[model samples]
Target: MKSQLFTIAIAAFVASLSYARSYANEAKSEQRMNVLFLASDDLNSWLLGDTNRYAGKVVAPNLTKLAESGVNFKRAYTAAPVCSPSRTAFFSGVAPWTSGHYHNTPGANSSEPLKSALSMAGFFKKAGYSTAGYGKITHGWDQGEHWDEKIGHKRDPAPPGAPLTPSGRGEQDWGPIHLAEEEMNDTLNVDNAIHRLQQEHDKPFFIACGTFNPHMPWYVPQKYFDMFPLDEVTTPELREDDLDDVPEWGVELTLGKQKYVDSVFEHGLHKEGVQAYLATTAYADAQLGRVLDALDKSPYRDNTVVVFLTDHGFHLAEKHHWQKATLWEEATHTLMMIRAPGVTPAGGAACERFVSLLDIYPTLAELCGLEPPDYLDGRSLVPLLRNPEAEWQSTAITGLTSKGGPTWHPYLSIRSETGRYIRYVDGQEEFYDTSKDPHEWTNSIGDPEYASVIKRMRAAIPSPSDAATPLPEVLKNTRE
Candidate 1:
């Protein structure tokens, strides 16, 4: 009887140990954070502002709500003001000046040095997370292999509506579509993301949802157009001689695209174009709301990190320019907000310090307690995340190659908290005191008082040797 009782006691002890071990493993799994990366194409920072000039004119309630819940980098700028290069900088943690990928057609493989480098998705996948992406994430380059599961790029069909302008400028045209919202490409992408969020997964997942709205050919339901009536639409503040004080190179860049703006005004489509942009922006916001709602309902909601940013800013006849590719404030500034479950405080906070999109990779790695690649050019934004008012010493850098110009001829711009400085390869320069001239209407490069400021900003640009190699023979002839 005594022997049998001792054996039963030993058996019970072993069973208790097994149960404790199982619970430990489960807790470890639960602690691993999931990542949800959201991206939009050609979204201007002006549209996201509530106190700026365009405030209350655009409707994006979901985005506004998200900003309230996270930390919004109010002055976040892109590494490059173009789609492919900006996205590339975020993924590879390499700046355009370092990779020479100034256009929208180059891929990670295009740069020999980055061929084997792991993208953000690839990094998470290697670390045992299930990674997936949908819509326009990598420009025209195919990053399908980098993701464990990916939805191929989808092109939106021309909406069955009349052209707003007579130019009928292919993808640049905008009109109201006559189809259901469910048929929209952006809506379909959101649906795909929602389905993935609802599925049960044994491992943490990294899901990327990219929306192509307000990009071009802004086609959405007529109801969206109705949101902004023609009479109520407000154009951005424009100066008739905005480019007069600018340098020759700067003036040339503005004049080259003045024709597009001329066409819009000539056809009396300026108000209509602005209306289309606001409407498409609203449509994108609705899709974002759907994804956010799905996540809130999912079990992983408490452990997930959400990041939303635009590839780059868009120009709607601002600074006499109609599109992106210029180094001006309108084209370089973008929207960036991050929501970390426990690290970020509940109430939305704004960080006014200068930050580049290149910091996204290192920021994620630091948040997850993972080691980032040694080649990352951007410093981690973890410090700013922890304390928005912390003293930061970094500057935002942006680069652009002239449209249809030689690859070696690139312009680099650097922005600090107080001023913006631009220098072309040909020795031309532009300087703006952001505090005094927010619209960058006046050039202060020649002012003696700003000589010290210009000297400091000029020192921030990368040396010629640090810039990316020229495009290959096959890609050199490609136009924007």
Candidate 2:
């Protein structure tokens, strides 16, 4: 009987050990690096450091803190400048030229059918990661349908119409408030993120929180506006002869947005627009701080990775432009800040490699130890992130062509480390020695001295692939 008892005890001990092993494995899987992807609407690189010279225009203490803890990429770009196509390239890891996604519509109309694409979210979900996409996941995808849970009833509905404010058309306000009053609304989105965080999910989370502030009609609490006095707000250096050397193409691109950017020429409107952008940015920064604060107070603080970016840069009366969709430096560049513990070098390590939104997929894939699919157009920026002084520098490309525009020359821009090359497909080109002329006042495209540099920059264009694929058979048979 003693021997029998001994055997039973051994068996019990083995079972206990097995159970402990299973629990440990489960914890490891559950502890995958949760992501807090904070995207801004049309935010540019200039607004981050004193780089844009306007960082002080807004008091974004939270973003400043976040940057203190993370790495802010000084030179980051978008594959395309337009919203839909650029956003599409962000997910597909390729350019719109190849995907047949020229404009916001076409294949990526508001209603799309790709339930499963090479999107980062789809990729993460497939790898046992629980995804939560809130507010503007991408330009093409059904943002609500894409996430496991959405913020509002539908993914992209205007919140229950609140008491509408006056057509505060000309100037920027602190927002969600009025000209006189300084009320605020933080619960709309930041609270939603916190609520999602509180929920219990077995899989690690990939939360994308995109803020629509500072996009247009910049709205924030008047409190934020009070932070930036109008007279103190620094404006873009407005030169009278800014466009003298700019070609017809560049001039056209700059002046085209005159209609949409309504507040540019209004009385002290430029100041308000700048103030509004800063106020909206500061407000968004506060909203982000809430998320970061929550993460710090939660069980997932040390293990989570945070990525903040903007779709593209917004133009506030600069060069007479309001929004993006241009191939200029302001429009082509984006705001990219990442905070991944143990992965990203902290304390404002600036990386100047020519990278686009397309790099996001491979970078995340490498960081998380996942195998990226074969069809992605961008390569992993892991090596560069590891070594800030990475040597392999290539130029990033952005294209611009409106369906109804008079000038048929597709605006193509190549932003390199040393200089910039902008050309219309029809042969008109502008070359700016960014090393010397950062303001891009001089056009040296046809200059004999810079002939070789121009040739090299032009050849940097990605070799045509299936993107150069011929048109559909039905189109071939259609009458012109």
Top-lDDT candidate index: 1
Model 2 per-residue lDDT tens digits across residues 1-480: 999999998998899578546634654564567788777776666556544534445576776677667766667788777677777777656455444454564445422213224677777777778888666557754434446765531222222233122324333222445432212333356677877777776777888777666565565566877888888987776656666777776777667566544444544466666776777777777777887788778777777788787777766666667677777777887877777776667554767677777777877776666677755666777666666676666667776665433222356678887578877755678898877776666778777988888898887754323343433321222212
* Tens digit of per-residue lDDT, candidate 1, span 202-282: 988899998989788888998999999888888788888887887777777777678888888888887888888899999
C-alpha positional error of residue 416 in candidate 2 after TM-score superposition, expressed in Å: 1.2
Any idea what lDDT model 1 has? 0.80
Point to the candidate with the largest TM-score: 1
lDDT of model 2 at position 308 = 80
Clashing pairs in 1: none
lDDT of all predictions, in order shown?
0.80, 0.65
Which portions of model 2 miss their true places by more than 4 Å? 1-31, 53-56, 105-116, 142-146, 152-187, 259-263, 346-348, 403-410, 463-480
